[model samples]
Target chain A: MQKVVKSFGANTVLNALDLDIAKGEIVSLIGPSGSGKSTLLRCINLLEPIDDGEIWFGGIDISVPGYDPNPVRRRIGMVFQSYNLFPHMSVMENICLAPVRVLGRKANDTKAQALALLEQFGLADKAKSYPDQLSGGQQQRVAIVRALTIEPEVLLLDEITSALDPELVGEVLDAVRNLRNTGMTVVLATHEMSFAREISDTVCMLDGGVIIEKGSPESIFTNATNPRTRQFLSRVNSR
Target chain B: MIATVSTLAVAITLIVAIPKMPRWDRVKKSFFNGEVLGETFPKLLDAFVLDIKIFLWSVPIILFIAMLVAVTRNSRSPALFPLRILAVVYVDVMRGVPVLLWIYLIGFGVPGLGLERPWNSPLLWGTVALVLTYATYVSEVFRAGIESVHESQRAAARSLGLSNAQTMRHVVLPQAVRRVIPPLMNDMVSLQKDVALVSLIGPIEILRQAGIDKSKFASFTPYVGAAIIFLAITIPMTRTTDWLLERERRRTSGTRVS
Candidate 1:
């Protein structure tokens, strides 16, 4: 994304923000609430249209006016803070919905793939269960599996663990860690400073809709030079 | 023992007081004359078939119209602004007008417009009027159900590469329809009764037949007979709606044992 601009009436949420992600890289966005981290992620996925900028992905401009985002969205997966599982559907149905309907995959083939993905996530037993029947942690895992079933090139995770209990957060984080091991290109917005420190190839600290500081996690976390970065880190560390 | 004695006392007192009630004989002759009731029951039941037919045919059309109106009203696209306005205007106008008036206007007024043969048919016009009126109310129910779904569900479906229509079909509407079933069913019950309104337009439904019988016999027993037929149909429908709603509640609440 180059110079992406997004505004809500008077409040400019993403102000000419530019970001580039290499294949198989894990980039983490850390910021205070309302700092535009989620907005940036949404813009990348074409969930929000940019006012003035170009987003080049897979050698095409996705932000072009009236561009059909569905095709591009197929290549980008996103997981929300709340596990927005289709409550009316079972886990397997939720997992298979996009694959069979959007991708036009055969139903039986997609069901097999969905079941395999569930087995891989240690949720094989939950295939028949509704979302409300599962724990928050398990539901979040199903959400990840739902996204992965599409085999997206880039995965956007917006505060995926923020709504989970402290104990359940670890399992969701571990799922992200496992995705990183498989070399999926992931960009996540998080408050988990230590997890970002451990997993992110690049940590971008956003403030007021701009990337104020970007570097390796060690430099950004410990030897940060920017005053605002230092202040934000200090406040977070104090907590 | 006390509960049984009190219940018996109430029953005995009501039985003893029945004959002494004011105008009892007149009331019995008017409402419950055996000969009039025997003559009225079958005709009312037979004529009620038309009511059932109207309800059956109008329901699907009403639901389809409601869904379309609700979706149009809920749209956020700038291009759909005109359509949204039209939907809002339609719902407001239809809901504000008395349904009986709609029946009269459509039934009589359309025929006067010198339209085609089908449009001139009072029965068809009556059906259309009922659908238009009831759909306005049902659309609001649909809109409430659709909006009640969390925004995150839309976000999730969109992020999965589903188009807006696809998302609505696979994710949003299924949940919305499930949530709105009880209210929708309640509307259907009201709709069943509203079918009687169409009788004013010359379709010989139960109430119209009862009126004919009352004029012929100079007794109100046929009207009571019509009321019984309406209750017979409506009571089962009401109970079915309640049972379905309770079952849905139990299933979603995870309180179902098996």
Candidate 2:
């Protein structure tokens, strides 16, 4: 994404933001409450139409006028802060829905793959349960599995564990940690500073809708350069 | 002790007061004539078959139209603006008019056009009018259910590459329909009774057949008998809706739509 611009009327959320994510890297976006971290992830997924700029994925500009976002979205999966699992469906159905409907995979084939994915997530026993029946951690894991079933090239996590209980957060974070070993490219907007520092290959601190500074977690967390970065980190660390 | 005494008081008052009325003898002969009731019961039941047939056919059509209108009205795409306007107008106009008037106009007026045999049939026009009116209200129910689903749900499905139609089919409608079942079933109750309205145009349904027997016997007892037939179906339907509603409320402590 180069010079991505997004705004809601007079309030400009992202101002000509440019970000390049590599094939197998994990990038974490850290920012204050009203910053554009979530908006940026939405733009990348083409869930929100960008006001201006170019997003090139797989050698194609997906932001062109009247461009269908569905084809591009299929290759970039996203998980929300709230695990938006379809409550009407069971855990297995939640995971299998996109695989069958969007990917046109056979129902039995998708169910088999979904069961295996549930096993990997340590949620094998939850296959028959509804979302409300599971802990927040388990539901978030099902959400991740739902995203991954589409075989997306890039996975965007928008504060995936923000809604979990303190005790449940670790389990969901561990699921994302396990995904990193598969060499999948992942980007996330998060408030968990320590977790971001632990997993992110690159940390981008956003302020007032632009990347003020971005570097390795070591450089940004400790040896920060920008005054805004220092101020943001101080407030975050004190909390 | 207070509850039991009040209940017995009301029941005793109604039983004693109603029988002592100045015209109780004629009232009984008119509305409660056992001979007229027994004579007309089988024929009224026979004519009710038409009402059931009309109801069976109209229900699916109403549900389909209601679903389509609901989805069209809920669309956010600017390209669908005209269709959305059209849907809004259709719902407003259909809901604004009384169902009885719609039946009378379309039922009696359309056949006046002198179209061919099938098209000229008042049964077809009457059922069409019923569908038009009921679909509007059912669509409103559908819209409430659809909107009751949180916005985050749509965001979730769209993020997973499902198109608008696919999202509605896979994610939204299932939840929406679940939330509105009790209300929709209430509509079914009203519509089952309203199915008898088609008799006003022509074909002799239960209500029409009762009117025929009332004149033939020169008594009102057949109307009571017809009311019984309707109550037989409607009372159970109404009780089921109440039971579903009660269970739903108990399950969630307030029947939370979300």
Best by TM-score, which number?
2
- Residue clash pairs of candidate 1: none
RMSD of each: 3.1, 2.9
Model 2 lDDT at residue A216 = 99
Candidate 2 per-residue lDDT over residues B192-252, each given as its tens digit = 9999899988899999999999999999999999899999998998898788767754542
lDDT (10s digit) by residue, model 2, range A50-137: 9998988888899897889998889999999888998878888899888889999999999999999999888899888878777777
Q: Across residues A1-239, which tens digit of lDDT does each residue of candidate 1 receive?
A: 88888999999998888888898999999988999999898888888888999999988999999999999999999998888999888899999999998999999999899988888778999998888888888888899999999999889998888877888677777778888877799999999898789889999999998899999999999999899999999999999
RMSD of 2: 2.9
**Chain B TM, per prediction:** 0.90, 0.90
Q: What is the lDDT of residue A238 in candidate 1?
A: 96
TM-score of every prediction relative to native? 0.92, 0.92
Indicate the worst ten consecutive residues by lDDT in candidate 2 chain A.
A167-176
Candidate 1 chain A weakest ten by summed lDDT = A167-176
Model 2, stretches more than 4 Å misplaced? B1-13, B20-25, B241-258
Candidate 2 displacement at residue B95 in angstroms: 2.3
Please state the error at residue A224 of candidate 1 in Å. Answer: 1.6
* Cα lDDT listed for each candidate: 0.91, 0.91
